[model samples]
Target: MEQLKKLDKIKVAIADDLDFFRKVLVDIFEEEEEFIVSGVYKNGQELIKNIFAIKPDIILTDFKMPDGDGLYVIEKINEMKYNIPVILISSYAKQDNEGILECLEKGAVDIIEKPTEQSFKASFDLLKTSLLKKIRYIYNNCVVLNQVKTVESKTTDYIAIGASTGGTKAIETIMRDVKRLSKTTIFISQHMPARYTTAFAQRLNSICSNGITEAINGEKIKSGHCYIAPGNFNLIFAGDHIELTDASKQIVSPGIDIMFQSFVSEAEKTCGILLTGMGSDGATGLKKLHDHGAITVVQDERSSVVYGMPKSAIEIFIVDYILPLNLIAGFINSISQ
Candidate 1:
């Protein structure tokens, strides 16, 4: 909670139709020293009409609200040219639905999945804690980030990314700034449950300048569009296309090493970018890619929420450039040019 001390005393608003949820959320805020709950609304229309008066530091809203949904709240905020970051709470993480993604593109900062069990005692505590942590992160980021987009530069034929924990925002920022992504194929091995990966892909696509989608089995890797290896499966390159295999059996599906190994075999003359993420997932794979003539870059500790992945890569001498998130675009652009 030390990292969150700075966030105590910020204004917040909750827009959900459920009385129980509102009560629980208000209780959590009251217990926190820094959080001040300004208003609670039963519908999107009520919040939209009065939110300007509250001018909350952050907003937490349910996906389905009376009159309008969370997406509507995002739209209303954007229409006013306000930078209020709304976190959308949804009940699903499967089937690749675009409902949450739609709100993100419209200006929602993030989304979290609420449990479907309908038992508040089982889930409310976790939800409240996670939401509080998320709000603090969002507030700090807004203070530091003048722009939501990443800087743009050159892209290479080979790309690899890894993420966990706070990787969602990192991926969105990178994709938003990558205006000139090369036609070469890119692969990401993120640490997440399979059902959640689809949502993550959708979120990335919403903010990215180019295209991004969840990878299908035996699909050919192409340029302009970013590919995420399906959940619970490792993505391996087979000649020109990619394959997803059961990670539980092989013990490494959707893994950075496996993805890079496949790429190095087929395209050693490519570039690899390992962004913010947890664990040493990409370190070994990046070293192999570097050994095979691939350009390698890792995010710096300061820019990374968790420096494990990039730190391992740098220590192993697998990363040729250790740069900040913002400078990565320019560095690659200069070299690629």
Candidate 2:
């Protein structure tokens, strides 16, 4: 892994309505040398009003607040085109899978289970550790938004996308922007927890023209649809059908490498795309795809949330194109047409 970039303390702005919880977080951050509490707001409305002026490197906001909520802050930040990463600290993360998916879909980098009134005292240590770890992880993997490039057309029967970390937004962008895909089937290998995949697939299905669903074992593959590997399990291409594998032993569940490698036999009809992610799981498999006559694309560093997966594939000199997020969908469409 690449070393963390040398920089000053990571500036964090926090939004929460509760005084005690806010102070607890402030105190915790104050004790850590890595973070500096740049601003504190009682609600998302206040945060939005001063966020640009404060220019925090990260936003840690509560899901529920008096004037505005975490969703409000996320929508505002995105509307303003700021690149700052947002993490939703929410009690709802434990029970509301759909709500958590909404945050992820709206562009939040990650979500943490906030301590409730009952769990606060006992969960303090765990919460503190989680906060620090998530902050550092986001700081290290943040991406600089980039412009898109046009693609030359080619025919493809299958499209495989691999992503992790900030992949929810990345995948959403492609699915939302890509023109109707009637000629090819799409497959996605996203690193996510087991509980969220169904909701994620449903979220994608709502916005994408192509139907989306969690891949099922023994299901026959077909065009005009998109299938996402179920979280914690591997989805493999088995000629005319799909196969689900136990991914407990793999380093990352729904391992991108396993999915990409499984398509070698169909390489001539496949387009392998490696998007923003935190690890190198898809690199070797993408190389195999490239060598086996598949079209290979990697999200460029400027457009990647982590750049780790794409960088690994690029390093192996296997990719045919390095694209920004904006162009990927159009490029896929170009090939499909």
Candidate 3:
């Protein structure tokens, strides 16, 4: 407790149309010395006007603001190139699973569902815990947004990708840079919630030339496409195609290790690429792939948002190359050629 007090309190900005809800956030922060309410605004317009002046470490905004919405705030923040993390709060019904994915794609680090009136006490307790935990996690592992290069390559047989935390953006960068190959099949296992994965897959499909789709159970994994493992299941390669199963009850959905372990038996002419993430989910699996004669690569710490996954793999001495985010696509293309 004494050590915690010595550390700087996290500065938070609140933007919502409801005066009552804004006060509720203030009151919650008042109870905890670890956080300080830096500014409170009634609408997105007000928050946008004084955002830089207030300079809060994090922002909590409602999905539907009178002047501008949460998406507007997020876009404007991105335009300004501020690394500040934003969290959106909405009633569960208002923002469906797709809407939640939209918020994440727009750059909100996380989302919180508002509790109902009847169960305010109990739900608010859970909400407070979830909000603070996400804020701290994102704050500690802030990502450095970087640009990547596009490259065309000869076709390879198979490629596997694992990422988490700030991985959505990283994956987007990688996918955008690579030219679609007719004979290469890409498998991605990104750490995400169940409902949001579908939207994420759709979003990627719209941007990349390669066909990107959410992995389904017993689907024939085809070449010239990218398959994202559904957030509720683990994507495993059974023979020539892919299968989704809930056999592993791991904490993180679409566990990288589970997917990587599945590649050991079918490690013929395979390449495993581990990107930025929070935990050591891909370490052991990547080691297995290496031991089974597969090319293994990890994103270096300098280019990663959170270096936990790659660092874990490096510590285990299984990585073939540690490359920066910008060079990863080129490296992949070179190896395939």
Candidate 4:
């Protein structure tokens, strides 16, 4: 019971031109003690007019509103420099639509796939759960942004990051803000099953500043590209290039230790960022990098999903900087630059 109450309650406003959908979203919030429905606007214009008065924590708005739409609301927020976080809902989220991309560029933080086929009652009920997770991530990202101010690091040959559960959102937030330095590359190890790597890369590439893709076997790992380790294999460097191969053990999933160990063979001055996650998959790998004079950073315990990895790394005296997920980008820039 105590743990259940730890979730933060957030104020929210729903904006959609559809009358039934607007009330449904509002009802979803009213049903949860963890969320407060501050206002319901039928169109983007009404939302823009009353946002100042409501001052909600998050905005859940549909893209088909009158007067304005999701894109318009996003543009206005950016033009006005509003600090609020907005989550855009559209049926196109499931499709390969550019609307989601445009929303991100305009300042909306997360995009959700709204069920267009479902009736208002069913869709709103489902949204209650999904919105909770998205809003938590958004609020947490907001918390980190307040702490870390710098956007990009100084120029370096490479940057490497390692993480597990909760890493997806963390990595996306970091990548969105970091401006690419010329001739720099990034390597990442996110412990996902073999089935998810391609979609992960495609989805990640949408938000990242640099090109993002799954590591192909024998690929000549080079600077300026972001390499995501292919799932179900050990991603390591055999000769200063990424080599995707099966782990020596019966363990089928791709691991992180070999990835960091091999990369540190030559790129000793690189920056290593370990983010919010569970387990110890990345601790050994990060420590290996730290031993080679790399600038090592581990997410602080307070902001982590599970502190296992960072905790182990810190105990070994390998992590040079202890920061929250947001502070990591700034710390990287300060050191690399």
Candidate 5:
């Protein structure tokens, strides 16, 4: 008797109002061998009602639906403490930037545009690629990170921070809690758009005691000041000065690795902090800093929105301290003092 191969499939649930579009989504997932369509709902209300029974690994939901919307579903999932990653699919993504941002804030892991009848083929092709990438990304980064390395406390003159995804809220919390530094110069490299970085800096400055501003080219670094790396650009150290470089070609803009690597020569005086972010962007650079005797700290898994960056650094055995979100600011203050 010939034995058949059994596949472990990733269960996917969908919630969309339009019948034709819902059918199209089901058809798309049905063609993939690794994916199993677990349940389909016409609106957020139906999905929420049966979510516990379906137990989907991932969810794809339309942004606007009667009875309940994608944002409502995300809020409900958070309230229920369900860890399933949800992705928002919207037809008006091109024009609704604010709405998309709000969805991200509400707990959607990622977002993509829904295919319209006119551009079905082309739009669906890109959507399929992005959708598959996000799904794999969520599962691929499910690395367990509970280990903590003991490190002696050391005073630091320079501080570098890197973050992405849920970084804005994390950064705000840190900056607000941190008392003004007397001699430390902080550098922040957050993944953001060019137009928003200035506004972000302004927001941080209003809440924090330290002077926070977007870094400029060939500017001398000052103590008790925080420099935010401009979006779509890389911030690098140039002997106590800062320089900005165009980073359009790079996979992750405002490359945290570049900023972290620049401190290699002055490692003993620098403190590298990698916060919550996706992928392994800053892990290697933090490793280099650690090898050279620099203080390296990573946000612990439980406190992180996405533990990809910290997990990567931890896996490499280069992290010095793993603290929760609330303790990071105090840790930095203690190190500087």
Candidate 6:
């Protein structure tokens, strides 16, 4: 344990209503030297009250709590303009749950299941491993948004974008800049749960001039419009129309690689843009697209919320341009024009 303490430690804050669960979390982290429990709260209200003072790198919060819920904590953190990321913990996470979806839309980064079936030791072991992995990923790869360059005019036949983790904000930034685009059909596959995709599509449509909508089966691809892959389904193109499939049939929900691969045969004039995300979902598909003559763009490390996806694509040596978040839109515009 002493030798383990020599490694870098990740600061963690935990909030749960049940005393037993709270104590369980504290004990679990105590055994792991790589994690230091900055604070543990019995409720969301307590966590919010002491959050700034604790200044934890990330928060692990229960979905439902007696005095204010996880959503309340997230809202409070936003109100205070804190950069901390929150992970919602629940017994079960249904993709259709409005509260879960709302928490995600409101800015909670990810969700995990609270172990309830196993013995204390078993549960602690599993939770600690999963929790530590997420903490390390968020700590190491979280990107800060820098000022973006002004976009220049450009036009393309189709644009396909894949993102996860910090995707919502990154997509918003890109769409805001590219709203002036004409004659381009944009397809977005963001790693999100089911009901939240509709909310996200509506949110994006409201902010940007682009006609953004959640994708439905058998819908024809249209120019100057943006289609978002529904959370429970994988968005793929069949000839000239969009198709939604049960994501369980694929590797990842709204799989970026699946969508990118589907575009390979039909992509005559295409550009594949892989944005900030947590995994290497789009690397293989992006490589296929790049080999097929599509202009491939990736978000640079400085602007990526998590560099995993972009880093994987870069490692494969398939990327055409590696640009910062701010410059991606302008670069795309310049190339497409």
Runs in model 5 lying further than 4 Å from the true structure: 1-153
What RMSD value applies to candidate 3?
Answer: 12.6
Clashing pairs in 3: none
Compared with the true structure, what per-residue lDDT tens digits does model 6 show for residues 1-337? 0011112676789999878888887887798777889998888998988976876767899998789889999899767645467889987576438889898876687788887745656677677788778767765543211111112123458889999989999999878766455677889999988879999999999988778999989988777789999998989978779888889665567999989998888555778899999879999999898888777778878668899999999899746566556545555445442
> Ten consecutive residues with minimal summed lDDT in candidate 4?
143-152
* Colliding pairs, model 2: none
lDDT for 271 in candidate 1 is 72
- For each candidate, the alpha-carbon lDDT, in order, equals 0.70, 0.83, 0.78, 0.70, 0.82, 0.78
Tens digit of per-residue lDDT, candidate 3, span 1-337 = 0001212777889998887789888998889888999899998888888987877878999987678888888888866655467889987536477767877865676688877567788888898888878777765543222211112122347888999978999999888767767877889999998889999999999998789999988888787789999987999977677888893477997989989888887675678889999989999999898888777878878568999999999999746666656556655555452
lDDT, candidate 1, 270-299, per-residue tens: 677787877788788778877877777777
Q: Tell me each candidate's TM-score.
A: 0.52, 0.56, 0.54, 0.54, 0.56, 0.54
Using TM-score as the yardstick, the better of models 1 and 3 is 3
Model 3 poorest ten-residue lDDT run: 144-153
Which candidate, 2 or 4, has the higher lDDT? 2
- After best superposition, candidate 2 residue 83: deviation in angstroms? 21
Q: Which candidate gets the maximum lDDT versus the true structure? A: 2
Task: Give candidate 6's TM-score.
Answer: 0.54
Off by over 4 Å in 4: 1-155, 248-252, 334-337
